[model samples]
Target chain A: MTEFQAGPLSLSFGRKQVLHEVRTEVLRGGTMTALLGPNGSGKSTFLRAVAGVIRANGPIMLDGMNLARMSVQEKARYCAYMPQLLPPPVRMSVVEVVLLSLRLGGNYVGASAAMERVDAVLASLGIMHLADAMMGELSGGQRQMIGLAQALVRSPKLLLLDEPLSALDPRYQFIVMDALKRETVLRNMVTLVVLHDPAVALRQVDSAMMLRTGRVIASGVVEDIVTPEIMAEAYGVRARIERGSDGAAMVSVEGVV
Target chain B: MKERSNTESVQRALLCRRLLIIALLLSGLIAAVLWNLVCGASHLPLDLLLKALFSGPDDHLEGSAGVILWQLRLPMVLMSAVTGLSLGLAGAEMQTVLDNPLASPFTLGLSAASAFGASLAIILGLYIPGLPSEWSIAGNAFLFSIGSAFLLEMVVRLRGASAETVILFGIAMVFAFQAMVSMLQFVASEDSLQDLVFWTMGSVTRADWTKLTLLSSVFSAVMIWSFRDSLPLTALRFGDDRAAGLGVDVRRVRLAALIRISLLAALAVAFSGTIGFVGLVAPHIARRLVGEDHRLYLPAAALSGGIILCLACLAARTLVPGEVLPVGIMTALVGVPFFLGIVLRREKTE
Candidate 1:
């Protein structure tokens, strides 16, 4: 029953505008949306702007609350942002890193309650065995999983993940997407994920937003948005969309436009 | 359910291990303090030393032992402990906020600026106008070191407080202040030059109750402030963007940490002169012992700092009987080898 909306967001780095009056369609809870674009198209910037990780000129409202006016801490109460980079290999244990998300922003939980939450998130992600392992000793893919666990542990209303599956192998990517979809539906949370592969987006997400040069090229259901013309305009690549036996759309990139 | 139980037990064991390490460090500090109390020029036997300590300073006991205990050994011992704790805590925070293991109070030009201030006071008799001549050296050192901290803060404000900017600017300040100290040294008279050099060598022999009380109070205040932000500080190790995403005000945290580091480090260097390596090496030792969860790491670093200085003080007293060497020289001599060992061991392990 929750709704998230951000619009007319504009941001610039010195002279170059990274996002220009960009807006997202009303993203409802209990569904995953893909943010797809080529390099320099402001996919990450738009996500960061919505999450309030950086300042942008516009309003962001979630469940009738104005997020743009909120402080970073206040925004964090409802939004969980997982950056594109994998968590660095520090000497902290995986559980310790995941537990850190609950330690701040005025939502202080007691020790046992926090530990229960961490365990639940790790178990859900199937990284339960890594709970006691040092983050420094984990592989890149495992660290990415840890990052996802950290994002989910807070149980925020809006989950913003920037390229969460980039470092993951194909199996892990599938597992992570499945976990994301399950968690989003179970928690009834609004999830926005930046993804590179339109094929993955066509197969996984319910809807997609395509951006080009900091503006939205198209936004609609995944089937309608992954058309060959939009793909060429957004990613400079010629593509074909074919329906599989299961009646799911799958994108096949032919070549560079 | 069994997996949950196992994980909980493993976490409990880690906590127990950390607590035990901290307990051991505390005990080591106590032993080092006692050893420092007894190892001076006229060694008071353990029983007599205990009796004198129990009788208190106000009670005029039997012998020169009481006089030495109250006047000479006690002030010096307490000063070393307090100063060591201050620098160690400051260094730990500095390293964390700056995100570089090499960062310390010394790396930030506080010691270099204090050396210049002490040199000016020693060679030129230049001091704060209202201060008594006897307090000139320490007061001037305090003023300049704190002033340098303010200058660094200004640079951070102007340049966005990135780790690289702060570290590079601090290095620039270090060289600038060292050059000024050398200029002062070039024109100093032979006697004044020797006195200035001795002051820079850093000894607690000049420790008095007034300086000790001021430094102890400051150290306690900074320690409380640091622990208050321990969770956010620990989050910072993950990186600024990640910490920010977790609702930490990274800029505010870094600024507050800088202020605390300045107060503790500036005061310690002012009172004790340029005591190096304790700030640089103590945190590394603490990290090796307790890992990087600042709650435990901070206290362990403080205790390790105190122990290192206490042992350095003991070496200063005993290295040449009846002739106390500069404790600063002892720290560098002791610290360099130990620091090298930690570095080499870490390299091998990695």
Candidate 2:
């Protein structure tokens, strides 16, 4: 079984401690977890820490291998992180960039199938028509999808994303999250995506990891944790959670939270 | 989709550019040779110029076309090509490596340091005049020119620097080197003043075969050795954090490119005395024509810079009909309007 666990990771930037002792574990072939939090709640910082894009002190282990000890090339084979902001001025065609993300020779996972898998991913995202386009000329949402697709090209065991749905409209939001959720389970990979809203993920993700003030406020099955009381306390406003009569998992926030 | 076509167009343009660059380079060789042999103050026709070229060394027509072709004109054309190509490649690489289009060797204080080195050589050097028709000096001006390049680079990479801050640091280095040169100039002797003025004006009239070959080899080695890193430099354009996520060794690439470009700029400046604008203008033109991919930009910029200098030299030597002007002044004068138009029309500050 694949298990990625981070133990009490701590980091500070200059004078401010952005992420306190935060801890979470994502099980392989099990759950698509969302890092849920309000703005400035250290969710982004924690996601970055999980990806090891910057230096921090803590125990972050993947399949019992200590991430802090692994070389960058070693880590690259199993993990990929998509930052919150992506610049598209690289003068790369979408196809060329797709080629860039494929492992040079082989990988820890399904390296040989990367090109076919990525082509399908582009089609599923409705960007297959843009396969020959430059990333620089795409709409904001299209570019974001391409950026997400590039990170997934290596078929990484762990995928980390930050605020991928913020500026996106509701339709794109549903399309992106659903695709990611479906792909994670199909590939049996662990996904950690940071999202501001959970409306689109009601029927998609299997689990949720909520953060408040740099600490894990809750972590469990999606239905059990995304409650009215907890979310109200988390976002510091009122909210309502009533289960659907048909046994479907859905939560609605009619009030501020 | 618009996206598909834009990318396809960019790709097609690059392929066409590669072919065009090859053609231009092939013609550049023939042009360099032709310009050197013909079109001098004495204006030898091709028939005599060919004879001057085919005949053995130290032989000439009564008009002494050999002295014009073999002794003076040949070396000058060779060095100008070398210097222009080196500066163009260095500037383009620097901007691409830093992911900052505004960065150039000249704006980053390389020229100032080279001028300082040349000034120092002029003011204080042991002169020899009898051993073998000698005008050699004790000054190892070449070595000092490299030292100043290192100093300017170190300042740019100091503890905290964004790309703009780095350019500002280079500007400071220029002012500092300029002050040093001013001090040296104040101490220079009357007899050597004329020599300093001629050297600083950046004329290729004193160019020779020996100097051309040496400069050509060194500059070519620098560009060729650094070519492998061009893609990684493009990968850098995706932003530092994303590149690091892709396992890029960002520090190593930055350091190697900087050191190599430093040598290229210093050597060219030492040879030609701080010719400006080729470093700035050639890369700007290359980006407009070929896009920002360094794998294509570097070689194209080198070719363009060479052709531009060759044409500028032709104009400089022929404009007045009686007196030959320095090539540097023409490059500066011509480059200014083109640069201004690009800058004025450019949509982004980059």
Candidate 3:
């Protein structure tokens, strides 16, 4: 069964088409599935469509109900979409942003519960020391982590992250992705992430939906479909996909063809 | 958790500051009223003034003092306080909701709209023979104030809906309104032009109990309903997109704030002519005393505004040998130096 229940989605911006005949769904309770694509490949567009920030042609169904049909408050409760992870557009403290996520539901989990959730997410991401920092004061990578911590407070049924790990340095890259993977699995959620590179794809993501020109180039389980042909087609690069002695996946870009 | 505690403490201090402003304002208003009654061109002793107020209807101890206090001074004092209270709080709301420090009703073209309307009434009265000029003047003032508010809102919307951009657009509209008012002035008969000019300068001598009562009621209602949204409005200092992500509907909040501001400003300008500077500078005083928290900023602004206007009116009635200075000029002159001091001091501290 489709984990996502999206229906007949269409979108356009003025005279240009952003999403065309776009349809996607995950297996319920799936792994960190990456929405892989080039620039303007509609990855961010699709993520926002699911979050209902922008109105689109089709209905996104979570567990079979139409998503846009839900009220703004309702959609916010079921899905937490982290868009581009820019430093919060204001001087709000990190704790304020995190607390806001829990408050969005109006369930307004009491102070203790709200703090516990914030503390847990911050600890998981290893950024408890910077809790008091203003969002505008943080480094890009640190801001991205804080952004992730904010989304994690809600523990939604589905998480839509736009380039969740793109700006992160190598040491913290896997750590962030690993935490996302762990949270999705432990919480039994369906997470759709947008990723740019193969390093993130082969190392962390469970499935890949490679898109080009607003169309899906490939989609399947990580090992079966993340082949040299699809990578070359999607990124326009000649690439090598190999299995090492340690039985880990390896991808190298030979060059653009 | 610790930071949350800090926020709460800051909020509490702001509340204390607001209450202090309220206490100070009430005391100042009473003192001004008494001063207006006592220190007139004729120095009536305290005993005679008390007799005039309390004695039997038939036993008239002082005729001029009673006429002066009841008919002239009381109404003017009340009008000054009411107009200031409404305009100041509304200005605070405008600055906060627009997220621009420079926002005020005057900056947003409202005062110019009022001036244009008053100018039109004066210029047209010579040609039109039968219309009640007083009603025409008040009606035109009220209509144009609302029209300017709508125009300001439209320009702001057209400018991409950013708060800062909207305020800039409003400033542009103010210049347009002022240009039209200047054109109207260019053609007026000199005698009528003098009356129009004095109205533009803003005076409270025309005040009556009826206008005072209505303004007080309208401002009090707006302030009460708006208090619940004060913390949320401050949350907007974090920016609207984030505020919305945190459960505030930014557009809805902005619209609500705009309507209240429009209503209050239009009423004040209509009833008391075009008072300026009260809206622009009162919020700065409130912010300095309390801090950036709107929950307190708004009420403190309201009270401080009332005190400033009442004291200015008292000075207008008593100062400069017998002539009454337009309260607007007095406020503008005093407010400029004070605002400059605050700005300079703030620059040093920062």
Candidate 4:
């Protein structure tokens, strides 16, 4: 099993700090960790820092490799980050876009192999039918799924997805999360996801790290740390955690505290 | 099995269509170049033109026809083709890296800066002391255009290589150079002003075998290197942040591309003055024809650019018999209409 550890990470924009002493440890071989926070809580910043897309203080170690020390190209080989905002519509096919990702992602897999890999990732995401469709023609949810496929096609060791379910419908949210879970497990990869839906997080993630005001409030197993008290403290709301019909823990917010 | 074969057949059809488009553009280029060679200020009959091109200099019955073919028209025609090719490729790369369809060598004021350099040399008698007077204008244009490019690079480095920064700085450079060129024209002597105006009008007559060789080498080297980075450049179409997420060093790639863009524009303007339309319109034509794949679009843009310039040169010659018109005027005449049509069509579609 591979372990990814980032400890005491600090990030700032100009003089204002966005992430303060944030830390996380994820074990590979199909482990999905959920990063939960309100707006401006540094969830995206943490992911960006770990992806080596942004500069941050402290070390991010992935299988003993320091991600912070690695070059952009080197870091890309180990990790892929799918941002929240979908790319604007371009005149490229979904398949072409995925192929572009694979080529630039530092793995010069041959044409046939690369195409095959792209097809496989698209199919895994249940988007094989949309492969030939132009990106500009896809809906917002579909575009996000293709973006995920682009990130996954690189076969990265660590996948960081910021608000992957933001644009998805309930059905697609479930489907994409399921696909991500399967892909992560089967590939023995580590994935860090930011999910606004607590119910989805409770059902899909193995562990959870909650943050507030650029600091971690709790970090533990998803079911253990996402109690009513933690939710009230983190979100400043009176809340209850109750089991749903699907046997998943759902956060029920009564009112603002 | 049937589905797989269907897909294969569709792919084959697409490939065939792409090849056909490339072939059509290539034939257009060859035809334009040949037409330019045959018909000029002094018309050579087809037979004489062919003979002058293939036969030894000593074998010609008349030395004048040979001189016209070998010395004046051929070099000018080839120079026009190379200039178009460089600007076309540079424009395509600029648009890709900047992620703005309107971006080009001309838009960035590189050509304007080159014109300023040439005007400075012609009007002020500014020449490198050891260099011949003939080489001075070209050398000065190259130096100034490259200087503008470096200025752009410095701005990008200081302010962050955002597309907005590059574009804003480029627009500033353009206005600054245009004003300088105007001031030079204001103070120039009548003969110097005429010379400066002709240089600005853009002509292929400045090219000889030596300049042609230099242009060819630079164009070939840059094109080859750019081809190697085609994959990364393709990824850049998704915008910089997404490109960075995929492992591309966006700043480094943008800088490298800006340098190449400057070099291409400088070389083109150094020998041929400031031909404007090809740099701005060629890439749009290529994108429309071949979609956004840089591998196909880059070369397609180059070929289209060469064809357009050659046709412009041909028109410049034939439009007024025995009186040569500057190739620069023809490109604007030809390209601006095409550009307007594209804009109109895009408006209708979007």
Candidate 2 stretches with Cα past 4 Å from truth are A12-18, A29-31, A38-41, A103-121, A166-175, A196-204, A211-217, A222-257, B1-33, B44-63, B121-169, B191-200, B345-350
Q: Sort candidate 1 into its docking category.
A: medium
**Candidate achieving higher TM-score, 1 or 2:** 1
Residue-level lDDT of model 2, residues B241-264, one tens digit each, is 666566666677777777777677
For every candidate, give the share of true A-B contacts it also has.
0.73, 0.40, 0.11, 0.67
Candidate 4 lDDT over A33-147, as tens digits, reads: 9999778888888888877778899999889889899888888988888878786687777777787888787667786677678777877888877877888899888888888
Model 4 residue runs over 4 Å out of place are: A169-171, A196-199, A225-228, A252-257, B1-16, B56-59, B121-126, B129-143, B146-172, B337-350
Q: lDDT: which is higher, 1 or 4?
A: 1
Decoy 3 TM-score against native: 0.74
lDDT of 1 at B284: 88
Candidate 3 local distance difference test against the native:
0.72
Query: Which prediction has the highest TM-score against the true structure?
Result: 1
Instruction: Label model 2 with its docking quality class.
Output: acceptable
Error of 2 at B241 (Å): 1.6
DockQ of each: 0.71, 0.35, 0.20, 0.62
Best-to-worst ranking by DockQ: 1, 4, 2, 3
Model 1 misplaced stretches (Cα beyond 4 Å): A242-252, B117-172, B188-195, B337-350
Q: Compare the candidates by lDDT and give the number of the best one.
A: 1
lDDT at B307, model 2: 71
Clashes of each: 0, 2, 1, 0
- TM-scores of the models, in the given order? 0.91, 0.81, 0.74, 0.90
What would the TM-score be for candidate 4 when compared with the true structure?
0.90
